[model samples]
Target: MNTILKQFLLVSSIYLFTPTVDAYSLNDSLTKGTAALSSATQVKGEAQQLVGQLQSQLGVSQAQAVGGTGAMLQLAKNQLGANTMSTLSGNATGLSSLLGGSSGLSKNLLSNISSMSGVQSAFSALGMDPAMIQQFLPIVLGFFGEQGVGSTLLGQLQSLWTPAK
Candidate 1:
């Protein structure tokens, strides 16, 4: 009976004294979540700066800016292909986010805008005239130029966005 009592006490003490192990603690989870949110905000801020420029310069709404810019980028991606677009995105911070991380509305609006006509349709959907594509070209090109995109890539984007005579 004494041995049984000793074993019981030992087991109880072991359980009571043992530290709990968690893969992710509440504090750790919160820290990681905060870090992720901060990173996302930075990316969004970069995108917002570009969008704001488009809106203010063109007198368009936020949706128009995002959709128009996204349409142009999608068209570029389609024309330049993924590898070249990757190079462009590498040179320009937040370009990838504009391409893939904008709001769901812009994504849905611009996802199919891989061709010139699609771009026009996207502009029409946003209540902007198709002629606005020309207006958006220089601003986007200038934005890329300011972002340190090389002249070669800028030339390619310009040619892609420009209509042939």
Candidate 2:
């Protein structure tokens, strides 16, 4: 009876003292989840600021602002190539999110807009006049300028966006 009691005590102590693997893994997962949520929130806030600006300045709806900005960014991506667009996106917060698949428009739709005419059509599809693209351009350029985009890149964007006479 004495030996059995000692063995039971030793087993109980071992179980009590041993650290749980699940606890450490759960903590790590929670930390990662929190960081990811924070990053997503920051991106959403930055995009919201731009969307708010577009809505107030252009008198457009939230969907219009997102779709228009997405259209323009999609055009820039098509014209500038992935590396250049990556640089541009790095300079501007939430720029990538605007062009991301989750932005109001679908990935397939954004990928389809490779030119100014395509942008205009996208604008039209968003219930905005195609000419509104002109208004959106200046505001978007100004926003990029404020975000510290280089003049050379800005010039390239301007040239790409400007309608030919």
Candidate 3:
């Protein structure tokens, strides 16, 4: 009888302690997963915010681009003959055509907006509101043009929206 009692006692203690060990590991895994998810969510939110900043900037920039291109085209028209003006107008139309892919110009602009990490971070560091930086869009658009970024962004958006045909 004494031997039986000691064997039963040992079995019960082992089973109880084994569960505590497993419970700890389970809790640790859950904690790590939760932390990772939280970090991912934050990055996504920041990325969306950065996208918004870019969109606002793009609207202003596109307007400026169209306006400037129009003005230049007009000036050239005034200085040159109808034939020369036609050439300049055709070129501007071609440039703007790239912006007007199937998804429209806004999607292309949105893509450019997402890729603007350096510009966004600079704005952040300076404590400058992205919306408040309207005056600077033309300058930034010029930079984007120089870098061949605008067309690249348009291409990216086009690929995303292009039909599988």
| All candidates: TM-score | 0.66, 0.69, 0.22
For candidate 3, lDDT tens digit of each residue in 71-159?
Answer: 22222333343454344334333332222223332222222222234224323322344333333444433433443444654343233
C-alpha lDDT of all candidate models, in order: 0.70, 0.74, 0.36
**Backbone clashes in model 3, listed as residue pairs:** none
Q: What order do candidates take by TM-score, descending?
A: 2, 1, 3
Error of 1 at 7 (Å): 98
lDDT by residue for model 2 (87-137), tens: 766766676666644533255557877889988877776678988988988
The candidate scoring highest on lDDT is 2
Worst 10 residues of 2 by lDDT: 34-43
Better of 2 and 3 by TM-score: 2
In model 1, what lDDT does residue 90 have? 72
Task: Report the CA-based lDDT of candidate 2 relative to the real structure.
Answer: 0.74
Root-mean-square deviation (CA) per prediction: 16.9, 16.8, 20.0
